[model samples]
Target: MQSSSSYPEAVEQLIAGFRRLPGVGARTAERLALAVLRWTPEELHDFGLLLATLPERVGECRVCGNLAEDDLCPVCRDPARDQSIICVVENADQVPVIERSGGHRGLYHVLGGRIVPLDGIGPEDLRIGELRARLDSGEVRELVLATGSDIEGEATATYLARELRRPGLAITRIATGIPVGADLAFADSATLATALNSRRPVG
Candidate 1:
């Protein structure tokens, strides 16, 4: 196809890079690239360095699979956190959302992603074995399913609840304060707190 872009090739390349970011549409990406052009060379260099070194600076938490600067995340390393309660979430992003709510002081378990068969995602695709290993230690007394309210999230929670159910293990699901089909990552702090506080037994 013939090129329709009026801007220089460098500007188009920068815009294309911005478009790769989530929620950055064509116009928004172009705007962002133009905004970057307004920045000082030093500032742009710093920004590029930050992005380039991000992988080396941050890694997945060895314990909960959340983003971390070290092998263990801050939460996992905290002695004051209640290790007896493990609030299960779909991804690392949801961890900060729940933390910001200030309702949960328990440990976390990141499932990586929810079970969506239509997308070729299943229980086997998740970190279910690692979660089971956590439970095997007998330190966790409760398993709170704090996954999203969406179909795939609900299905993942149901499957987990059944698989992890055992005597003395209190399995529960967060309340429906979040709207249906909404992700926990997008929930407000207050709403997330209410949902966490009102969580009920799942099985």
Candidate 2:
């Protein structure tokens, strides 16, 4: 498995590590390993430092649960944004996709993940409690469930809709047929905007 002429063990270990990443096969991992080996000493050191410090440098926002360097994410802290409306998403990765659409001016709540019974993920495993707390604050007027159209996403939406139902609060689910199970990160801005604009009431 050692393809490198020099430091075979180190190169193979690096390749194996890369291979563990999603969508990265052995061939791609080998190529990445070779690329790293070819980098200058300073470049390699910088890259290593970035990887090592990334976790410590970035953390989830306490309010919205999005990746942030400070207590609150930019979206949550933005005064111009409509705090009365909250868009609920499955993860931080989906935030940029909805932002790119420029259709939503409300705040956001990241669930961290969806409900997947098969994978042993339940409503309690997500940020459902925090969402309920936010809803109880009486500040939010509408909760847009922007979760994916997949089974797990749907289940999560249903759970939230049922749990959060109350007077003076509007619960809506994003329009469907956006290539079910597809990650919102890959959806085009236009499509995402349309979906948000056409969201339907749930529960």
Candidate 3:
């Protein structure tokens, strides 16, 4: 489809690329492209280099599914962590929020995403197999579900809690004190701390 702008193809292409970003709109993307035009040659080169190298610079943690430069995330690599308790979150971004809460000293498991049947995303679509593999080691005694409070999140947590029951495994869900449908990734540290502290075992 033809762009709505009268700019040269290069500028339009740049705007189109920016528009593909998560929250960027057509106007915002155009503005961003214009802003980039004002950057110095060195700045432009640096930005291009960073964008080009992003894929190689970041990769999934083999142990936890979190973003990592190496095979293991920092939490997994640290010997001081409590390996007996695994906090499961919907995405890698939620890991930092919980870490900042200072409530959990255990390892994390990033599910990559929650189960949303409407979106055709199931347990197999996420990193659930990896999480199960981690638990099979018998090191994890507690599985804390830290998914969001939304419908999909609640459903996902419920499914996991029911499916992962085993002897010696204590599965729990983070407290629902946070507003309903709230995303855990953007929750305040104090709230996250409270949720983690008040987590109750799944019946």
CA lDDT scores, all candidates in order: 0.89, 0.88, 0.88
**What 10-residue stretch in candidate 3 is worst by lDDT?**
177-186
Q: What TM-score would each prediction reach against the true structure?
A: 0.88, 0.87, 0.82
Residue pairs with clashing backbones, model 1: none
What is the alpha-carbon lDDT for the whole of candidate 1?
0.89
Between prediction 2 and prediction 3, the one with superior lDDT is: 2
lDDT for each residue of candidate 3 in 1-203, tens digit (9 for 90 to 100): 24446898899889989989988998888889999999999999999999899999889999999889888888999999999999988888888888999999999998888898988998899888888898899999999998888788889999999888889999999998654443665678898799999999984
Report the C-alpha lDDT of model 2 over 15-54, residue by residue, as the tens digit.
8899899899878998898888889999999999999999
Off by over 4 Å in 3: 1-9, 23-31, 179-182
RMSD of 3: 3.0
- Model 2 bad stretches (over 4 Å): 2-7
Q: Over the stretch 88-203, how does candidate 1's per-residue lDDT look in tens digits?
A: 98889889989999989999999998888988988998999999999999989999998878787788889999999998899999998775443667788998899999999996
Is candidate 1 or 3 superior in TM-score? 1
- Judge candidate 2 against the unseen true structure and give its global Cα lDDT, from 0 to 1: 0.88
**Structural RMSD, model 1:** 2.5
